[model samples]
Target: MAANAISPVAARWIRAWLILLGLLVYATILVGGATRLTDSGLSITEWQPVKGALPPLDEASWLAEFDKYRETTQYKLQNHGMSLAEFQFIYWWEWGHRQLGRFIGLVAVIGLAVFAARRWLGGGLGWKLLGLVALGGLQGAIGWWMVASGMGDTDRVSVAPYRLMTHFSLALLILCVITWLWLSLRGAPRAAAPEGRRTSILLLALVFMQMAAGALVAGLDAGRSYNDWPLMAGELVPSHYIQGDLGIRSLFEGRAATQFNHRVLAYVLWGLSLWAAWRYWGGALARPFAVLAALVSAQALWGILTLLNAAPLTLALVHQGLGVIVTLAAVYLVWRAAAPATPSPVQE
Candidate 1:
């Protein structure tokens, strides 16, 4: 018996498909942020995975959906007096978000099916695609879970920040996997020195942690609370960071503490990015390292502008998008650093 194998051309096409899927996921993140910022996630009020993709096609359907939303705490507490037209505005954002997720899942299933039918899934290709499908399914559940957190609680208008963070973190995890696989399929470069690889890995971890902190900041609406950059509420450190019941919980639940920690982490990440670029200046990973430095610097500026401007929609979206870009840069750096020492000839 012979081992099943795909041609190089087929593999390239599959990788290209994965890249496109990855971009779609990135777009989903941007849209997701917009939905959250606009308070649209809870507008749907129900999770209909199969039937929900079509959305409300007529006035009657729209009214029915709006009626369901009226029952949610988000509508009662935060969106009271929201007219039907205003309700539609948010409905579309959440609907489109779900539709996109469905489309991504559809595309993944179709890609895997077509590849398998053609015997193009070889060398663990099938398992990889299956794993992504599983993750995508989990993300859908997480999305609903996040929204459900705020649904019945009349005291809360937004989903728990921690749940929102978990949703975003999983999305990033999926993105990172897709990105690394795509980079690996492109062509393996000569591996970096052992010390360089270790440092790059460390940088990647720090960047991820910083993004999680940003999630907490978003969850707590901490950015809106402190409009000052270099200082928060007219001080280097606000008077009361530990105002919550538990000392440790303040780090995650307290707005002031979360925002303060996010700022501190951003500065630390910036410093580390500079060091990464310096360390890799003459190595194979130099390009990615430099790109990471530039991205982190721009991200810092964006964060400040978004903060000083009170996180206006446009700037806040840009800030979130740049955070994704920075993460991609870090992932690329790690990928390059971890490549085996033997280089494949750069393909055309």
Candidate 2:
């Protein structure tokens, strides 16, 4: 082994640590989806990174927290006359989401510190790990920003759609990066296929765009509208595709427009995935493309079901979780497709 190389055992330890952290991040995303679905995101009303770790302990503390939430536009306009018990319900959800985030940060920092202290992280891997930690911190800030949008003096009853999209998009981006790093540590590069690599990259990009589109749909509660298949409101395009005065912004803000966009992107992604699967069948990229095609098909179907059912909590979360899985699959394909034709020197 080279002087700077990380031992196989050390690499495995680092990989295991990353895998655990990745799973936590994945859970956090799901919890966030649940928070949105249940309208619990704005319940906390404050971003106390340290002091906020502990939820309201007694009735007075709980009421104090609830009192703060009562001032938000969402509580005033939407949840007016809500009971204290009901308040606790939403508060707990938001509190859990934030607590989970803090836990992830703790685990990430501690793992990096331990690995670095033991000199297990070599070949600049320590810096990469540190960068992920930094992104995690940024994500926490973005979460608070998203929550703040609803608490402001506006007619909005929930977080701004664009900010929600931004926060969700960043979470997925971090997940992709973590996945790519984990895949890199697997060792033994496969022979690269340029054509397949290009296709894989295209598919990954489409999947990511579709996720962002889905976020907009969730943000605007668009899936609850036009609950029909093949056609929205019995037309190829809804008559009110751009209902709001937001004009071009309607694509992201308008319920009809956002849902329409999400549906269109899903169709495009589904077709592209199937095509890639067929094109790469019996080739080096066959398995990954096949898995991608299957996942895309399932995701599209679930999405439709989610729409038809008015985006129920259970189905919506499942759809969102499956989307993450599909994304990880795409990341894996990209990593595999981009491998060097010959093995490269292994580093930690």
Best by TM-score: 2
lDDT of 1 by residue, 98-134 (tens): 9889999999999989988887776566787789889
Q: Each candidate: what lDDT?
A: 0.85, 0.89
The estimated TM-scores of all candidates read 0.94, 0.97
In model 1, state the lDDT of residue 124: 69
- Candidate 1 TM-score versus the reference: 0.94
Candidate 2 yields a Cα-based lDDT of: 0.89
Worst 10 residues of 1 by lDDT: 339-348
**Model 2 / residue 199 / CA error / Å:** 0.8
lDDT accuracy of residue 279 in candidate 1: 75
Q: In model 1, what lDDT does residue 83 have?
A: 93
- Residue 344, candidate 1: C-alpha displacement in angstroms: 8.4
| Backbone clash numbers for all candidates listed | 0, 0
